[model samples]
Target: MWTAIAGGIQYIIDMGASVMLPIFVAILSIIVGVKPGKAIRSGLILGVGFVGLSLIVNLMNDQLGPAAEAMSQRFGLSLSIVDIGWPGMSPITWASELAIIAIPLAIAINVVMLLTKLTRVVNIDIWNIWHMAFTGVMAYAVTGNIWIGVLGTAVHAVIAYKLGDLMAPMMVDYYELDGLTVPHGTSSYLAPVAAVVDFIIDKIPGLNKIDFNADTLQEKVGVLGEPVVIGFILGAAIGFLGGYAPDQALPLGINMSAVMVLMPKVVKCIMDGLMPLSERAKKIMNEKFSGESFYIGMDPAILLGDSQVVTAGLIFIPITLLIAVLVPGNRVLPFADLATIGFFIAGAVAVHKGNLFRTLISGILIMTLTIWIANQTVDWVTAIGVTTGSIQAGSVIAALDQGGCPISYVFTQLFTMQNVTGLVVIGVLYAICMVFYVNLSKKRAAALEAEDDEE
Candidate 1:
């Protein structure tokens, strides 16, 4: 009974998400010949007609309707399909336990990760975040254990956004331009240079005393936000130089520094907000944001062609660490964490990082895979598909009437000899898709080059 209710609710959520997918896809599809409003309305109508009503009603008929009818015959209380909306006992006990455990424990784990420098170098962003929350929600829906779901969702979301993305200064640059990207162009060659500098900084005896809180993301924003934080930092610096100044006005460029640092955020919050109403709003927004994609960054002027791999690798560390360690309990998952990491390494080893173009292609390939996985998994999955061939109704009814293995569970086993065959199937499908994409890209490149030579 509890299983029925949990499955029904989760199924509704999944169906709703699926219903919304067409709307989102249609909105994007407006660029390709469809009228946005018309496409949206049509999609919504079809979703309602086919999925919202028909699919669900049929599913309910197959599952709960049969069970309810059987119970009616036994107990002698007649109930219609409409009277019993969904079959299954409410999981009251399951939800009660989730709330108690998730909040405090997730917070504690996030704090620990922060102090230990686990996500220090990673760039945090919105996309990285959506995964953890989604994971948490799915985990609960699947397990029917509220605590597991709560813990998975809340912990995954907070640490990912806060310690991982928010506190880190590099996130601003990476997210605005290249969230979870690799380094490209001449900058690609400079990774080794930066690595050496970071190593030297770590070794500095007195310099090291100043705990370089890889807290640059927050500090940068704070010092740049209102000018007050920067003023305080600057005022402290001036006081440190008291011996040189003594009594003369060593007032020293404090306010000016504060304003300059804060100029961008101030504009973003105030001017940009107001600009939407200004005569130039559309032009400014489109010019700034629409011309290039989100990962591509602010303006092409600063787009170093080869940075995607390094940026991706840095951010990939957190994602990889969390996914592999927490999910499968395998702490050793590395480049494979990046959807395209293995392919890039194969190509790089074949040539070198000096092959910047190939590296960039590899980086794009990986990011695409990440996007695909997110898209596929973002929707809720409710219907546990099943099939049956009944024997003579009188003979076989009793076997099904008693408690037995769910047909879905049997289907699960037939596919995989081990547990969670669903996850294994998904992994295999993704690998096949990646190979197909890579081959297609190689073909397109060859075709384009041949045409260019002829012209």
Candidate 2:
């Protein structure tokens, strides 16, 4: 019976996010009192949005993946092990034995936290439960203890929900995404690096005053500074650096420009579907909980539609490679993740209020830290990949997403006792960043509330 249950859950997960999320959204909407017809319509719109996003992301992956590989080869980056990114990591995660139970386990934890008032985030982003599952399976792999693995999943979920709570106000104020919060993926785990960077920048005088974004560039150069033009130029430059001639580079440039133009249009579809559900959920929760506010946890992809995020993602293509070369003992070449590097820095852009200069500084720290951690986790990730047959025997793989997540790394090391000093350093540093992040988030939340009062 247990085996059958697990298998059933695995089958649902195997259906892919584009299908899985739509079903989840439709069900959740119906539960919140939306009419079945409207709920189904909303779900289909979300599905359409996901399909659009998939097309753009696949286009990005197809064009940039080879270009990135060529750039690494041209520069002799000497980085050996491949970083598979989420596309590869997701399948490996869902194939794990722990993944079957992780969805229910994470949901249970979220329920407990909500009831106990430990967190205000209603994390319905079921597809991203894989992040928590990845951490658990890694810990289980390292220590050979199923209990410890479960504990790791619990801990990661708790932190992820709290991260959702903390970032909610900023999500509303900056991204204008009211009633939603991102509590999944590297965006949640790595946001503390941005918080810490924001704190330090505040201490400096002239540096703190620096601000730039796509709008600033547009103001300076008129049409030439626009996102489409900027995307084309950056894309063509990347292709040229990847050793492509002008003839080939120009088409890549045009496609990237299309990506810039099209991403937000699809996101609008998602928002249109979500708005009614969000309003209904808010109304129901407020009535049930005596006017308490709650945020619906979601994936970080929503933030990718912002122009600043797209521009930063483009700039980081080269900057991340440069950082990879500079970081000592880094072996995982930045390839697969180069396409959607925006996800990593999306929250930082919000925390910095879209100041591109500050985002660049924090992004440097975030990617460098991510690369270092991915370098550390290659063996563990490769073990899972081989077990899932996602890669051949003796293949080494890592990812800048969950594979490099510090929550998994720190939790696993705590049990395995393999690099006590590294654990202590990262553990303490991350703890400090959490302190700053909590304080920063509280201020933002309070400010948001005050604005609400005025309105």
Q: Best-fitting candidate, measured by TM-score?
A: 2
Q: Poorest 10 consecutive residues of model 1 by lDDT? A: 396-405
Q: TM-scores across all candidates?
A: 0.24, 0.98
Candidate 1: residue 398 Cα off by (Å): 38
Residue 302 miss distance in model 1 (angstroms) = 17
- Residues 323-413 of candidate 2: C-alpha lDDT, one tens digit per residue: 9999999889988888999999998999999999999999999998899888888888887777656779976788988877888889988
Poorly placed runs, candidate 1 (over 4 Å):
1-106, 115-131, 154-267, 270-455
**Candidate 1 global CA lDDT score:** 0.30
TM-score of 1: 0.24
Which whole-number lDDT from 0 to 100 does residue 212 have in model 1?
18
TM-score of 2: 0.98
Q: Give the per-residue lDDT of model 1 (tens digit) for 62-132.
A: 43233323333444432211111111101111123332343344445544654564432222111122233
Q: Give residue 106's lDDT in candidate 1 (0 to 100).
A: 45
